[model samples]
Target: MFNSFLKLTSICFALLLLPISIMAQELPSSSLYVVTSCYVNEGSSFLDAVEEARATIPNDDNAANMMFFRQPIAGTNFEKNQFFRVVSWNNLQHWAQPRSLPATQEYSCDNHNRTFHTTRVVGTNGNTAYTDTDVAFVSARQCMAKDGVSLSEVYDWVDTRISRGQASRQNDNTMVQMSHKILGASPNVASGRMITIRRIGDSRQGYARFFDEQFMGTRDRTLGALPDAPFEFCTDANLTESYIVHSPGRGI
Candidate 1:
């Protein structure tokens, strides 16, 4: 078992260094993301599960990047020992490539329950030095477009928010990503919900400072009110401890 694990790790490492060519597709402006929830088996530690999952990363050139997130058990509806793995693809055509996971004692994840998101970054603070070991705080929420509001208008609202944060000097280490569900469970597909993800800082302290500035400092008053609501996002946001398990040098 030890030897097999080492072999798998080596293969994955090699694949990680390979350059992924951007595939020719109709939607060159965005990338496809697959988010999968993983549950660690009883008696297996989260670190063990992470190592096991890392060994199974797809080697195809279509696979752009992969990230692992440890979901908080408290204040969330996730089951115990739940983690998330998000994979990025160059295009939808490459997503059709056959992939499977080998049985593992550390954890079990079902690819079928995966949610597909078509994502594009709407705002950033210009800090792009992303690495595999970098840790980040993510706040995700589901949103629905307001009546008669186009998707572009919704994105413009997001941009305006980022601009406010920038003016207040509160978004130096933040990135805002907007995603639309292309394929997923019935509820998500039927609702036509959009996902807003805010990746704050490269470490836990960054998140701490962000909140402190928002609540304790005077910056909040200067940021100004939000523009007319272009989308109605859920008030309850899902927070996660996101870790970059594998980064392909492209800034997220």
Candidate 2:
């Protein structure tokens, strides 16, 4: 795997001023997040992972939140502890299996790797109905502070286009192309596979392949995108399909 961390926590970085419009969708006083958990050697049980999380999170932040993955964050009923979610690796069970268990499942001493990743945003109801694109920005000048003439200059050019309302121009697939170009150059920040977009109580997520020096095959790191919840690695469902229908839209 590409040096992927199992579980990561957010550091308290001061907020850079964002547009008030976008800021409005940000989670309340609490910092919003996109958490990803994965089990590499042998997938871990949902309950066990949840037990692991219980030891990691503070008590207050565990109240009234949402999680999504192979299914909704509920065990038949949405009741107490709507605040947390636990998803197993049953996500791609139908697609990944032929008709029987994989021969590998017989192997014991399997190591399960779980990851939690998130970004803070304002005001979404933590539902699937909301959608938006998230971008990480840096100044053409600042990005070159040491490396010199970084590709970030391209964003300023794109922003100029958007300011002129050309963000919709088909000939220019601004974001997608930029992702490829940047990864081609930096090759490191590109290690992250899940790109998440958050708004208020909800968010949209998608997984992409990232390069790793250690894997023989392309590691399929996509644990599907989720609303303010955990990413699901195996599932036949893509819930945001219903939510982001009317577009001419984009999000990270």
Candidate 3:
């Protein structure tokens, strides 16, 4: 009986390694992110669920190279708090097919789900690699220009801001990556949506300091000059902040 148990463990370990070893070397022009938001059950501890997921999620493997986060901001969606799971993959072709679940993640949550894909617009690395303990603060903006704004004008605005920031920084510490939303689940329009990622420290206070310095600092010093909002194409928008709960491995 012990021998059979050992065999099962070995097989599972090997299976986990297979995807990592076989992962593609090059990244695609775009990636898909499936964002799931849910509330923890009344009796279940969210932290406990995080601990179990850390043990079970095979983030080092192809399937594990995704991110999980918690959206602590309140007063939205009728004040129900939620967590998020972001799954990223280069190839859309194989995403729907059955894949083996990690032996470690033994948990679940409840809520509404939304998904979107982004096309790389500007950055040193268009993909994300998350850390286990460090909580990254992410700010995503979904926007559209008003009547007279052309798509190219909005594109130039973001592209120039990123380039200017990169040029001003003496080091890459203030680095920020931005992407344009290409496809999304309803109310998540594609035209002017932008997602910005910053590696703030592990705590909420730390994130606050970093956020201030990055966005509220002296004009064009940390992050480049803020671009004027183009209200010509469309006027609707949504912006939210979330904390990283899980880190993703390097993007292929």
Candidate 4:
């Protein structure tokens, strides 16, 4: 009788831990992102800034991907001529490799840098493939998990909604990314919070269609409905015009 009880207890414990082990294996590997916010110098146009960035920035084997996001001045906290530069690595090990930047005086901008651990929640863009002409309309916002809610729980909730086909109006070209601040963020944003970025389309027309679908067509009330979502996202979303600067397989 004693031996049977011991076996039963051990089996129950193993069963309880089984789901956790499976979830761990299913979790996607995260990438590291180095994001820089900058303001172009007075009298310098965006074209000049882009040219300077293309010439100076590292697009070597270590860097996984790079992008430039043009921030709109109206209805945004950003100053005039403000933009963002984002560089990503496959993992922390790759990012730790010694990479040097060549000296260049052509790039003129006041910049602040931050690092993040970014994970993909939906879509297939893993930040790997891109073309020079590919343009994306991006919407980013800060979010905080609710009390007793874990990050994995939030990911599971999003995954469930996505599986149900209620996540977004965009097609397969869309990508939803969640980024946790590893180096920098405002004091208002707590450490438990994360930044969510949604890339709507490959072009401006795709973004327009998204809005039209939201207002004109049937609304997706189930995407982030309360009682279903484990976290809450901020209402103030920053929209930007994103352009691919460098990608691995694509020629610069």
- The prediction achieving the highest lDDT against the true structure is 1
TM-score of each: 0.75, 0.21, 0.57, 0.77
Tens digits of lDDT, candidate 1, 74-136? 346788888887777766877787766467788777777988888777665545323233776
Off by over 4 Å in 4: 4-25, 73-75, 102-112, 124-132, 163-172, 218-225
Worst 10 residues of 1 by lDDT: 19-28
Q: Model 4, residue 46: what's the lDDT?
A: 63
| The 10-residue segment with the lowest total lDDT in model 3 | 231-240
lDDT preference between candidates 2 and 3, better one: 3
| Candidate 2 Cα errors over 4 Å, as ranges | 1-30, 37-61, 70-112, 121-252
Q: What is the lDDT of residue 117 in candidate 2?
A: 32
Question: Predictions ranked by TM-score, top down?
Answer: 4, 1, 3, 2
lDDT of each: 0.64, 0.25, 0.49, 0.61
Per-residue lDDT of 83-201 in model 3, one digit per residue for the tens? 66665565566355556655423345432446555534454323232333344454444344544554455545555666665555443332233444544544644444444333323
- Report clash pairs, candidate 1: none
